[model samples]
Target chain A: MDWQKLISFITVLVTLFLIVRSEIKKYKLRKTRPCGSDCNCAVLKEVSLKKLK
Target chain B: MNYFAIIGNPNCGKTTIFNELTGLRQKVGNYPGVTVEKKEGKILFKDGTEITLLDLPGTYSLTANSPDEKIVSDILLRKRIDIQRPEGIVCVVDASNLERNLYLVSQIIDQRFPLIIVLNMVDVAEDTGLIIDVGKLSKLLGVSVIKTVGIKRKGIDELKRAIQGKFQVSTAVRQWKLPEIVREEHEELTQLLIKHNSVKEDVAVYDAAALLSSPKQLKEFKDELKPEILDHVLLDHQRLESLGYDRHSIFVKSRIEWVRSICSEVVSIGEKKKSYTDIIDSIATHKFWGYIIFLTLMILMFQSIFTWATIPMNFISKGFDWIGYQLGALIPHGDLHDLIILGAVRGVGAVVTFLPQILLLFLFLGVLEDTGYMARAAFIMDRLMNKVGLHGKAFIPMLSSFACAIPGIMATRTIENPRDRLVTMMVAPLMSCSARLPVYSLLIAAFIPNLLVFGFWNLQGIVMISLYMLGLVMALLMAFIFKKTILKGKTPDFIMELPPYRLPSLKNILIQMWERSVLFLKKAGTIILGVSIILWFLATYPKIENGNPSEKLAHSFIGQAGQFIEPLMKPLGFDWKIDISILSSLLQREVFVSSISTIYNIQNADDKTVSLKSQMQKDLDTSTGLPRFTILTAICIMVYYVLAMQCMSTLTVVKRETNSWKWPFFQFAYMTGLAYLVTFIVYRVGLSFI
Candidate 1:
């Protein structure tokens, strides 16, 4: 493969990794943490859980 | 530096005061374990001391009825481990509603924190012919009261002075006493708390009163208390109720009485004249006229977003072309150049061009919200929302959804009922957000006839409005169905305070617009940048040897995927190229226009100047050999977007909001299914008629 192709490939991989990283982090965090407020409404619960941690 | 918290009722101008005091020094984050905003800002005292102000969520009382109220309760009780107990308190009360506003003040007095009462909206109170004696009120409550009009910056200096002054430890702030039975229970709980070292000596009384008064508020100290202790508290609460005085009424009735007594001494009316807001609300809230006014306002908003944004959008489109040309000259024409020009610049251009409409949408929304008409709109829509098993409070969130669903979903925190909030969250994405504008406009310009009705009304404008209204009607209908089916529950009775109308502050509107634009750009920089490059790689790889570039693209990875999905989209009148755009755009709706631009190999790819539109119009179907896009096809595409949850960011937020994969995936499935079914019928029936 040419140098251009190599750089482009690496960038795409990095981008994909970053995107997937956020989703996975959220998933792991959601499982471990309970929401701070006792309200049963889950609106923004992931962020709420993250804040609690 | 010390920490102080600003708490007040909703629509009591608490935010206005926060903004005036802090100006641009504010930082916003979610409160611990909740989506409620934790706004912190720094204020420098004249004596060179600094104070950090935390703007807590507006609450009616210390009672933890909602998540927002719980946050306030937790913070004031010093239960949250992440935050320190604030050194002082600024209780913002509306002078116009002094009696009700003082109810919160009385509760705060029970805590006996260093307190200052900020009587906000004193001008409004005066206009209503209600004169408030701030000094007398302060004397009676045994606290410092500063009268300020937050929006006008009136008495702000005095408020600052009061905050800097040494707070007094008053012995007489708690005027209302509990009944003999409840007082005995409170003392027993206080003794238990002190014995167990559950609270400090001073906090024992407040904690005991809170725990005995409302058992649910004990959740604030769930980590520290044993199960048996909690059960004991509940048992005591039941005993108090069994002894004939209800816990809620015992607290509420005494508090109301205290507030009334204070107001009677310090408040008087000069005259009771009908204010301008009263005159306006008569028509704006009228059953028939209200609906008409609302429809007219929505139509005007949609029309402006469609027609007024065109000039700047064209300019933004051309700006991208100029950048592309400059890059062509500066960089050697190769894979790097192609990727930068086609993938990055064009992708950014597509998203940036939607800025004008987004700003306009926020501009109108800010005006509605700032003028207090947004609450009125909700009040009017509550009757209809009731029919759909949704509360009227859901209307503000749904209205916000028209701008974008992220904030709209976040706004669902205002809806107290869990089920209703979830249902609102589910249907919010069905509102045609600004991201969908580029897709609709592109398809409409390419396919829909530009004929004007009666040589006056533009057909394209009407089509745009129809698409928006279609989303609204569908969202309401689906919300109704969802409420009846999967998320069925009792819709809470909506109680909203309608603040008097004021002219929307131009500075606030501009600041809101600026913030939204920055958020949009931030997304473009991060998620869109990543998605754009990845999609470009997918569309460019697996090159064909010694063939036409278009033919080479056909064999690319994304091209192959599109072809794989072609059969499924055939009923909706979408070709493989359109199908590919649909797949890529699931990450973001605006990506559809850019992905199509990249696939078609249009250099500038501006939707204006007829380049992209003409390309789309002349494109032929491989099988039918007819123009790829028709009026029917455009309608079908728009319908699909109107129904589909084609935004990953929205879904991520949904997962966060619902705290489960069950709801977001269910949202994806139901919205996608409905989109496909509706598009299929629209396309098939239209083909037969045409």
Candidate 2:
């Protein structure tokens, strides 16, 4: 492969690594939730931005 | 202990009330036969009483169309009740839109159940300077009315108390007001109810308009109704229409008038909260820029699916393949080793191939939906879609199809018009769904030289972009043709509310992503596993010893099946191996590439390390003296798969949503036929150029 092609491949590889890292972090976060009584703790609401305003 | 159900149109806040009353005590499970969920919980009142709250699907009216709407009618007549019927019903009405909301309320009243009204979003209406006299309105309707702002948990305790206040085993049955003449006729006829003082176990409106709106319900009512009751009902409906009030329409106009009158009495204008959605929507739904944004979003979606998930894909493929090899070494030599290495482990590895892209697809979709941007996306796309003699609702299905066609087609349930939905489903597969990306990425990398065009656009990116556009053009063209011919009908009038933008609920996004991944895995476990084993069996059985005993899979059942189809596809430059892979892809399109690898005995080849492009470059037909993959052949295959509806998951969704195998089966047949014809044309035309 030419230098440009090699560089392109490496750049893509880096991007791929970043994508996987982000995905695994998301998975780990989700897994810790563990389908318990606490699942409903999502607390569907705005973050009280009124106070900040 | 009696049960009650809360039902209304979407955004009615049935969920808010359920959360307020039940807290975390609800059980969320699927309705039987379909994946649509049912949420139910119980509340104990201070008066030594308890009530079960069934939060049915948020629906506009009781007419059964989609499985979601079917929940309303099903729960009312207690149809398909493995569980007990509720003694009472609470119909939710958005207070601001009371006039429109009460259309459903009146319909429920006709069912002759112990009904109550939970007027939600009262605060929003009040903030908009609208007032409502709840007591006066309650007296007019002769039903208990409870005011609630479910988001703030205000008046929830009162609503729960009211629910418990009226959970009687029975209520006095009152005939629906069908104007003067119908009231007189009802007096003359025999009592339709089980008792005068109790709610009718069942009630039917002799209104002609109701009959016109619902064929399924009318058909059933005709079989069961008393001759006189049925006769008078039809007459009353006609008489009302003569006065210019269609049974269904009049019921709405009057209720809306009543609600408006009550609001005039008690409500006053506050500072008008300007609808921010309008300002944002104006730009997003613009004719030109809206289309631009839609295309940009689609391109970004494709980029995420193909470019973002490469690492996880490589890891999974390499890891799984390594595991397969290790197991092969550990297992004793025999059919057992073949089954373990090539069938079970290899099959799993094959399915995992596309998991990264699927995950990314679900993640972005979840984010878009949870963040409330998808609603705006539909709104934006709707403007352009309407010009083509299609409804605005077509945008939702095509938008959702970007994640995967199956869910997208199923999502078409929200589109009220049947003809519109059918056309949407038929064309939805043409969207660059997550499923097609794997096949596209693999093929493009192998065929299209990786070089920049215009010193900017990568050749691979350009090809990917072209494939997406091709698919979209094909879908729209197909929809246009279908609308004009096969499923020809008037394009339904568009009416949809564009909800305000909200920060995406991260929790909801994560949960949705999890659910989709689990479902995909389950399907992969069954269909992909089965295909892999059958494939391994095809490529392995009846081995030729010099080439290895496992070389001649042609005598196997699957191999024979591929051979049978090979002659038809040979003109397209596809050999028997390609034929078999294409057949396997009836379950899923990605399986085609993996099957090709297996059939060619390149399953053990490290294509990732050597690059699939180089490997394909080296492969040749032993007798033909030409490479197996010519430029024309590559283009033909790409064009063919782009238009094909090869995913069984998509068909299953069509079947469930349509509640009939007819539409789904038709979709499969037409798509495959289109694929074949297009591939043939491409191959023939491109070969002439060469």
Candidate 3:
């Protein structure tokens, strides 16, 4: 076939693959890393105040 | 309605006010084709008026040293800038941190921008028992004042009314202009100010002092000033420098005083209560426990991405193979049938297959950043960052690369030191971003078994983690090496402002995620679409349909092409089939899968029963009459994709970020060379066994 059509077809196929791949990955994810980890990765800054004399 | 450019120090609630004004509708995208994200949105007035609000990067002053700070100066100047010149600017000041934030606002006043004083974070002010008279402060600064809690979306309508009335009403009362006393102090040394340029004759003294403080700027003004009066201006500036009012101090003191008075008047402090942010930060920044918690969070992100992303990937594989069959059935057994099944559909499917992981990675990163945890992550890494000759602030960009290198590279602009900035930019791309995950996943899935490594962990997962760690360690090593050798310079001293910890607004977080996802689809999608089409063509075309068709096309142009390269790659455990796959992989590394699938499918016309994976395991090489899963071939493929310059999108990013082809060209060359050498070693070593 012509180069243009081949390119067009590949574009469509890649899109389909990406969509399907994402969905499948999502489906598998439910089986792993169930979100409630006790790891407190949230960051914050601390300021120490001096006591009044 | 008048436009208001909400300007403040980087972490001083400027973005929060912008978010509050726009309400989850702002568009975040690359500035034109550049990587710098330009934020623009509008705020509607109470009287149905609309004022466009620009949220420029936070800067200490308009002296404009870095590109980010330059943006603040450029917008305020409205000269040679691409965006609209704001009619007025609502300077957002954290009442608690008035000195630094007001440093920018006072500079804005000199630019002669219409002014609205937005005393943000008044809640914090109130908690501290700080009382400020808003009306009196407004009179002192010659502008209107509005108190706002950007996170809670409070005092918004009042802000809107102020913006709407800015053009019609004159807020100019007490001028923040430099006192004649300060100017006279300089004049005692010489009449340099009047002699230098006709421009400064009517200009504010604050502007003149700011220019003199900058060494390069002082020289530039001296050189540019009319030669006839240069001596007087130089003499005057020297005299002014002696007066305890050097330009920077005078400038700083002026804004500090203005902000201090304004904050004291209207804000009232009540009982001191613990902030939600502080409570959470204590754990996140625990001296010892913080690191452990951070490690666990990281492991979760990686593990979840792989296990979660693989399911849809399988469905995608099956669906594409099925479509190939259906198209093969319809095309009357001609070249078109082959083209549809093998060339177009398969080519696109290979690249498209990885979208799920990319989207999920972006979504997770978006939440991390919006929640303020990401900044805290930088804070935690700062002590470590200093050892590597980078500021704690530089770690923010490095961490940002885990989601993608493009944004991470753009973020390096925050590094003030020119040497450190360039070093960060060069090594950032080495980080194994989410885009590289598919290559790692496919290789490990295909070659590495589910065997336990070191008794407990999965060997495949361990290998995957190793590759990522290797990249990071290399980046650090390279930065150290560059600092000592190529970029020999003293590392700049570190001074980073730690923003207050706040529970990130969920409304704002979701909006950021949506904007990023849409931008990825719009910008990266277009380029990927183009590349996908081109790759598909290289796999198809020049078909042979005549008698002895297999024999006729066996030695066709592509075969001959592959044949020429076959001997060269044989040491790496690659035959022509592997060579062709590598060639077709130019668009992206993952295309390696579909490329092999298409080639093998054409050879086995009994393609009805076997899946793509099955076909690969079953296909026999004529030379050996055995399956093609040679130990050498697997190693070669893995190493090649691991370091190769396979993604045009990456090169596109490099070009845009550096604003030149020189950097991207060097990037492609170095990475490809590194990939070739690494793959060669792996393939040759594997071949020794087979």
Candidate 4:
């Protein structure tokens, strides 16, 4: 392969990796935090439960 | 590090003081079980003594009627194992509203923590012809008092010095005497709690009084406490009721009387004059003029958003176009160049060009909030909201949803009733969040005429405002339906305190604008950029070596997927290309613009200098031999975006807030179903008019 093709290939790979990593991180964070990272919506379930009580 | 909590009533300038003390060193999170925000920051002193200052959610008292009050009470009583109890407390109060502010301070004093009273907004008090003898007030309250104007950074040094100084717990503040019979019962209950519940000596009296009045807390302690303590509390409550004394009123009345005595002694009024706030509020909150002013402001804001943003948006658009032209020249015509020029630049630029609109929206919201007009807006909206069976408190969250739905949903915690809160959450996403602005702005600017309407209002601005009003009207309609049918409830009485109008702090407004702008830019660089590259690859690969660009795109992976969905979208006047954009935008609404830009870039690769708008205008339907996107189609698209539940983050937050998947899924199904039905109707009806 030519040098330009090699560079493009690596860039695509890096892009794919970052996208996949971000999705995984977001999924795990959602499971644990539920509101995504930046929002202040985490721990709402406990509050909702208290409201129910 | 020593921990000190800052607690105050709402609108007491507590947050401003907290920001002044801990500039950029702050973290925001949610306290468990309530939507109250947990804001913590580190205050570093000159001598290297580090103190962690927690900005507790603003509450009137430790009465625990709402979650905010409960959280404050819990923290002060050291009941929350998740957070360490503060070693001391800094109780902030509005000096201008001293008589009412002192009520909460009296309750905090009962908690018996080493406390300091920071008299905030003292300048506002002085302006109203009120003079407070700070020294005499401090001696009477038995705590150190530091006068401050939090917004101006006045008295910050002395406030910090007090925080770092040796703390003193004053016993003299609780001189208010309860009736003898009630005092005997309270003492007995306090002893029982101390012995049986292991309650601390300093807070047992406060807890005993709280338990007697609040049945919610009594029920909470039922499971953990020994039955003897429960029986004792019940018996004490009965004994107090047997007499002519109301258990709750005794504590409240006695405290108020004492606070009133203290205020009368330390505060003196000079020659009175009406302030600017009162002068303005006469019209701002008047029944008839208020609505007119609000409508005029809405019109002005929408008009300015379009007119003021044009220059900067054009500059950004031209800059991106020039860069794309340069990149096309610098590299060979191949996949690498296509990825850079068509995919990344076009996609990011399409979204980035809308930054001015986003910033303007945030700036207006900031000014409204800082000038205390937002609260008045809520007060004004209360009657209409009540007509729809929603509390006035719900209007603030709805207003906030105009910026974004996540924080708006989180802000629903202030509504104490579960049904009302749930109903608010179910409809908040219908408000057009900032994410939808790009889609609306792009379509409006391209399709709607920019001529003056009646020689005053811009036609484009009117269309934009119509779309926003459509979202709001639909939201209120949904809220009414939810309240009447599924989550039926009565609208509770609405009471809100309107803070006096003050000049907005430019520094604070700019900081908010900068923070929100950076968030927008970050999303553009990351999620939008990623989706752009992926879409570009899907459109470019499996290349037909001998075919034209359109032919190659038609046979690509993305093209096939879009074709699969094209039949479903045809009723709305959308083709395969628009179908792909709709599908990609499910992750976030702004991605719709980026997806469209990327698709157009790939199709018109030979002409890199044409703007996206011009390219879109030039697109022709092969079958009809007419322009692809007509005014009808643009209106349909805008209507669809206004109602669609297209954001994943909002869905996740709804799930978290409800603690069940049932509500979020229900919300999604209804919103999307509504969007599809409305767009179809709009398309069919619009076509008839043509």
Q: iRMS of every model, one decimal?
A: 7.9, 19.3, 16.3, 3.7
| Comparing 3 and 4 on DockQ, the stronger one | 4
Extract clashing residue pairs from model 1.
A42-B657, A44-B657
Alpha-carbon TM-score of each model against the true structure: 0.88, 0.74, 0.78, 0.95
Tens-digit lDDT track of model 3 for B145-234: 788887788998788766767532234322444567664544432344445443433242433564545556667566566654456546
Q: Name the weakest run of 10 consecutive residues (lDDT summed) in model 3 chain B.
A: B27-36
Can you write out model 2's per-residue Cα lDDT over B1-690, one digit (the tens) per residue? 477777776666676577678763231111111112355677777776777777766666666655456655666755554556777788888887776676677666656668888888787687565777788777667778889877567888888777766532223233234456534544433244233222333433322334433445457668655676567556755765686655455444544565455456655566777766567667777778777876776567655566677788888878876887687678655555665555556556655677877787777776666445676676665655766656676777686677678556655655556677778888898887766766777677677777867775567767787887888778777888888887777776666655445455454456666766775676566555555655665566444565422235555566677778888999777877677877778767877766665554433323324434455666676577788886666777788888888886577556545556787789888888888888898888888899
User: What's the lDDT for residue B562 in model 1?
Assistant: 87
Q: Give model 4's docking category.
A: acceptable
Write the residue-wise lDDT of candidate 2 on A24-44 in tens digits.
553343322212112422110
lDDT of 4 by residue, B19-129 (tens): 889775222211111226556778999988788888777788776655555667777877788767888889999999998889888877777788899999899898898
Chain B only: TM-score of model 4: 0.96
Residue B202 displacement in candidate 2 (angstroms): 7.5
- Per-model lDDT: 0.76, 0.63, 0.61, 0.83
Please state the error at residue B463 of candidate 2 in Å: 3.9
Error of 3 at B50 (Å): 4.8
Candidate 4 local Cα displacement, residue B297, angstroms: 0.7
